[model samples]
Target: MAAPSAGDRGPRVTGAARGGTGRPALARCVAVDPTTFAAAYWGRAPLLSRAAQLGAPDGFTDLFSPADADELLSRRGLRTPFLRVAKEGRVLPETRYAGGGGAGAEITDQVLDERVLGLYADGATLVLQGLHRVWPALIDFARALGATLGQPLQVNAYLTPAGNQGFATHYDTHDVFVLQVDGGKHWRIHEPVLPDPLERQGWGGRAEEVSAVAQGPPALDVLLAPGDALYLPRGWLHSAQAQSESSLHLTVGIRALTRYALVEALLELAADDRRLRATLPFGLDVADADRIGPELTDTVAALRAWLAAATPAAVAARLRERAWAASRPAPIRPLAQAALIAALDRDTRLVVRAGLPWQLVPDGERVALRVFDRTVTFPGACAPALRALLTGAVSRVGDLPGLEDDRDRIVLARRLLREAVAVPADDLSGS
Candidate 1:
């Protein structure tokens, strides 16, 4: 399967809380137990969870309804990269249905429902990109899932009319959870031609092999209805077409880690080594193998030395930090926080920021508190206060048990708030 063009996919992640914490959305969204799925099928094969409903109460249906499509298309004036129209396995150009000039000379693409609807009537699939950024419900759900899975997450939606297909048989670079939100879609899933492909190894060049394999009997073929979900691991070939009724499904892609990513983190850590940072022999060129050979050999030896010194645990820790940096932080209200910080007091309630992952390390006389893309070191005497503050339980700044000085405790609390490691207990939005 060829990957969608950059515009079709749009900029990814250009886009959460406690009490609803610890519970991963995936647990509720899958029919089989999460443990069972992880142990048996995760990164191994396709999983079809029948009658799975994400975002409970209202289910996934409320996230984007037919009414929403009508409202967004006719009134939102969406531009390219936000919406894409594909027909018969090909994506239609934005200009085909979008325009540049209007009565006011507006430059953005105005999504005319009539034009979009007309294309849909003729079998085009409408794709909504970056829904996690645009929809609040999806944002919360994505965050919950990310925290649960310990990976970055993104969301997209595909709406295909009856008896139509969006794209030809293909595989995704990232694992996807396909949630059928409305109507039904017939799916044909084949075993991976190349199992566990990396991000750079896309689906484009392997079309012939994919086609050849797909011609044989599929490993799994079924019709997915509303509230149903299909989990396809990366590199698993699959395709789906709308049934007699139109279909709308959400694809929640997990940007999973690979060995290559771990190596990247290792390389970054190695850069600090003088040997790794040294320049190659000068005047090295395609024709100068004699000189190039020794230089290349030396570089390889140095890299090997770096690798030999590396421990798996240390490398894993670095990769974990990199992943945390890439993920979006728990939601925060800047204005509210600023106002609250200005009125800092002993009576203010604080709790560890919902869904925020943190680490505290002992640093001799100081304690290193690492969180929210930054690290702060405080006197070891404040360890009790810091530990209590990060216990995920709510507490008033004034009532913290171990800390006695109101001034010092208040200062530490304010610093924690500023770093986004904790939030006021009253702010439900932050939670």
Candidate 2:
């Protein structure tokens, strides 16, 4: 299935965290059980699972194939950042692989197939970023895997001609799973120069250290064949070179939650303390450590008091805001949803959007439906029907709970359909 154009989807972000199912996606990558992987190698170590050792006989081909890459590069009218080319260790400028699309397109950076072809022949590596945002299968797989791991995730694919390497020995600030989709790639992995690096600490800061680490004996040295997978935590030094044939692999990067994030949440909660916001003494020598010592001591005491009084619930709310805002729910076809609203009737079938995180909250006399970025409120009488439709399975408009009249049910269903909270069940067949 193809992706919806950004114009067709509007302001809604199509990438959501929930995979809408069980742990099958995680199974496809980690050879060990989920519990075992979490305890042993999740962030502290690396795990490698060969093609024969992983789940699903089809491996990763179903998620993304070579043909799929071609379709995106040539037919998807892709823009930069979403797709890029690298030779040696440098990313080629957009002009190298993209140019103006002919009349009516207006876009100047639409990918040019001939340009990509020339670069591939010259040993440039194709890096396709954000496959989860544009590719249907990857969208589902990433969402599922993120749900299982309780982390924000993204997917990128690398395609290199034989004997070429796209990037130098380095480490990412986030964890990664390398899923081999086609051919072979010889890999050399070494221990981390800096363990558990935060987002702000990039490999560039310690390029010298990383280069040094790569010179040491590898902790693991192996060729990843089709269907094989490798898991690496952040700060691990590594590099790969394509074998005889071309190499294609998907990198599923995980933004694992950290203690620092929790500290951020707690500090945000500290904003409520008036002492923390108070000014220092007037005419105080701010730059002098001797003069500032007493002030810092008092400030520490005040902060300690605030921390002692803080509640887990308060910090949790801030974390929820940060995490929820970073992700998006499934996209709705606006035009199709509009059509469904116009034709909504008792017999019309409807289902809540898959993996949508929403709830009905009491808002005075009205009840508010909290989903995505906005709160949609309805009169208190609609609560029963909202609960039935949102919390229940795929159902008929007439089947909504507590709304005695079929007209009331249809009206509620139509309003919800307009809100993009639910879609016509038949729309699920496509992406």
Best by lDDT: 2
Question: Could you tell me the lDDT of residue 61 within candidate 2?
Answer: 88
Task: Give all TM-scores, in the order shown.
Answer: 0.83, 0.90
Q: lDDT of model 1 at residue 130?
A: 79
lDDT of 2 by residue, 1-431 (tens): 12111111112223232332333678788888778888899899999999888755667888898999999998888988798899999989999998899989998888899999999999999999999899988887876676567677899999999999999999999999999999899999999888999999999989998988899899999999998999999988889999999999999999878999988987877877888899999999999999999999998998999888777656655666676565555667888888878888899888777646665666778887777567789988988778777766437888887777999898888888887788887776212
lDDT of 1 by residue, 334-364 (tens): 8888888889899998877666666677776
Segments in model 2 whose C-alpha atoms lie over 4 Å from true places: 1-23, 429-431
With a 3 Å backbone cut-off (N, CA, C), the pairs that clash in candidate 2 are: none
Model 1 segments more than 4 A misplaced: 1-24, 52-59, 71-80, 97-115, 278-297, 312-314, 361-368, 376-383, 401-404
TM-score of model 1 vs. true structure: 0.83
